[model samples]
Target: MNEVLVSEKLVVRVPCAVIEYNGKVLAGQRSAALSFPLKWEFPGGKAEKNESDEDALYREIKEELDVDIEIIQKLPVTSKDQGWREIILVPFICRLKTLQITLTEHEQILWLGPEELSSLDWTEADLNVIENYYEYLSVKK
Candidate 1:
């Protein structure tokens, strides 16, 4: 007989920004020093304990991109399970307060239209979020 142990997943809340400027969405390429390096993702970070999603996003955008953002509305949520953890991703539609972006944790950034969103290899969760955004657009249009 073999003994098996089961454990519950550790869920982490991550606040994400789907920032639009001049008809393009902001995407960041992960830094080489980070997990999933070089994969493109919307700018955001994990929420601290007791932090609201919006506040986490605001602080993350400021800290990571060196730009302030005004969140417009909530977008779709995406969830995924990694071997070590489970992620709950909440994305918000946002507008940039400044035109300039200074990245601290990303190698580079791109401004792309919906049609061009697939040009880069995105993180698994982000790819799902993009699909939801596309569906939202198709329904809206």
Candidate 2:
């Protein structure tokens, strides 16, 4: 069984990046050592106390992918319960500022199109993020 890191806190805040480049969104596969082993998700991590979601996203993308991103807009927030902890995912639509990516945390990464996003085995919160993002895109058009 996958070990879930139960948090003593009431709610955990996670900021995620929905990095877009050339009409594709970046998705990362969680490392096998992580809680959601091999599940696909946007690259980001838990927000520290007093840190904004945008700041956390910038820090996380740099730490995980070794690339800089420009936040374009904020997507709808998604929440999920792992039975051990509650997580609120703050997703942002971002533009990739650099081309070179060095993966430090994820097992692998992929640039997926709108139609392709739902084809992967994504985390539950990410599924919500994807849905919300697609709706956001549709409204923008």
Candidate 3:
């Protein structure tokens, strides 16, 4: 895992995932109860202590989406200062190993192609990372 500290307000290190299936990438709509509520984002969560990025991502996906993923490639890590807290978001290219659609935190899920990527109302941090991802990752179709 890549670690960086800008201030004492560091909040968490999140391992975000980009799961590609068929020709589209997976996105989830966050529940309105959470921060940045109702915005779209790549599925992932905070990394636990002593866990590698890959391991944290795998565990997060299984817990959040109820699916197993195989990490194909790890992309760059982006850091953001959210006033009271700072976040280090790490993104990855991954393949889904299960087809089940399960969610405990998100309201819904969508599989969108590259052309439809920018049309969603994504969280600022997610959109920033998505921009970086689009430079190298393309929709399969």
Candidate 4:
């Protein structure tokens, strides 16, 4: 007989910004130093214990991009299971407080139309976020 061990996976909550400017959305490419290097994702980070999602997003965007943003609305949440852990991405539609950006962690960033978003290699969770955002846009129009 074989023995099997099962345990609950860790869950991390991340608040992400879907920043838009002039009808284009912003995405950042993960630097080689990050876990998912080279994959594109929205700008944000994991929420620290006891921190609210909005506060976490503000702090993360400031730290990562060195810019401020006005969060407009919240989109449907997306999640992914990576075997070792599960990530729940809480996406917020936002606009930059300023046009200038200074990257701290990402290799680079791109501003792209919605149709062009699919061209980039996105993290699995972010793909779902894109789909939800698209649906929200379609319904809004």
Which candidate gets the maximum TM-score versus the true structure?
4
User: Against the hidden reference, what TM-scores do the models get?
Assistant: 0.92, 0.92, 0.89, 0.94
Judged by lDDT, which candidate is best?
Answer: 4
lDDT of 1 at 50: 93
Assess each prediction's global lDDT (C-alpha) against the native: 0.91, 0.93, 0.88, 0.96
* lDDT: the better of candidates 1 and 2: 2
What clash pairs does model 3 have?
Answer: none
Q: What residue pairs are clashing in model 2?
A: none
As for lDDT, the candidate ahead, 1 or 3, is: 1
Question: What does candidate 4's lDDT look like per residue over 22-126, in tens digits?
Answer: 999999999988888999999999999999999999999999999999999999999999998999999999999977899999999999999999999999999
TM-score, model 3 to reference: 0.89
Model 3 RMSD vs true structure: 5.9
Clashing pairs in 1: none
Count of clashes in candidate 4: 0
Q: Write the per-residue lDDT of candidate 3 for residues 45-141, one digit (tens) a residue.
A: 9999899878899989998999999898878788888887888899998898898968988999999996798999998888888887787665432
- Report the lDDT tens digits of candidate 2 across residue range 33-133: 99999999999999989999999999999999999999999998999997768899999999989989999999999998988999999999999999999
